[model samples]
Target: MNKHNAEYYISKLGLLPHPEGGYYKRTFQSEEQTSDQELSVEFEGKRRLYTSIYFLLGSDDVSHFHRLKSDELWYYHAGSPLTVHVIDEHGVYKEYKLGIDLENGEVPQVLVPKNSIFGSSVKDEDTFSLVGCMVSPGFEFQDFELFTQDELLAKYPQHQDIIMKLAYDLIPV
Candidate 1:
């Protein structure tokens, strides 16, 4: 076994600024793929934080907004039609759609900061994407917060009463 210090490896993992939050760093890249049906790595672990990968079914509205104690990176592997949205600390939100001004080269990626919210939507069928979250204090499944429409409406009724800025597309499954 290759014994390595977790802290050392964490530093080597390369953390970068998340587009949504300022409290975390994230890095996302693609891996060699021999087939369209290959399993992808969603998350990687090193020291202070780990990574997460996700698979979005085509046309399925996937909730993206989430706040983590760490940073997150999203890498688009297969499937051309995809949309990602994020809300910054200032409550400024932006949505990105793939295939629009999309360059033909490395897979596109998105960075999400700690304590920020973000979400994604898949337009093509049979789509796969990878997400990497680097938690400064590491991550625990218990810390995962999956929000629902009713719950969000109940919690932040003031925000919901406004203009319905957030659209409910998917329920936790």
Candidate 2:
């Protein structure tokens, strides 16, 4: 096995299965917080100033379509380039390549705006991508929203291919 393969990082970083797919471990959570009065209706209560995690996605893995109440920034750390698919609030679909290959339009950092339905995948066969994600105003279970195929299809029919590939076939009841 290669020294830096998916399993190698998973074990080294103490990554565990993430609800959104792939593997991850929270790396930071700021002590500073936002009070309930400062947060919007989407937030349940107080939230930390920011939170970060180390995320790993294998070529065969799917991050799945999900949205958060706060913006998320993704930074490429190692391995293959990652493709981040986004369907904005206005229904505009865009893809950002996160990697070090600048000439090919791959960016080292990409941002997913709040409320956008988005997902990520690693395209290189048999390899994986390691990344760091930071969410401002922190991240709470209540702020996370995973999509179902039918629900996303109803709203963004034009993004059928991506939605079908990334959205869950069935949402757990």
Specify the highest-lDDT model's number: 2
lDDT of 1 by residue, 1-173 (tens): 22132232224444332222211233322332232133132333323324443333234335435565456655554344456666656666666664433574233666667666566655455442323333433454444454545665565554453214334435434
Candidate 2 global lDDT: 0.93
Task: List the candidates' TM-scores in order.
Answer: 0.49, 0.96
Q: What are the runs in model 1 whose C-alpha is more than 4 Å off? A: 1-48, 98-107, 124-138, 150-173
Q: Which 10-residue window in model 1 sums to the lowest lDDT? A: 17-26
Residue 71 in model 1: lDDT: 69
Q: lDDT for each of the candidates?
A: 0.44, 0.93
State how far residue 131 of model 1 sits from its true place (Å): 6.3
Q: Give the TM-score of candidate 2.
A: 0.96
Model 1 has an lDDT value of 0.44
For candidate 1, give the lDDT of residue 16: 37
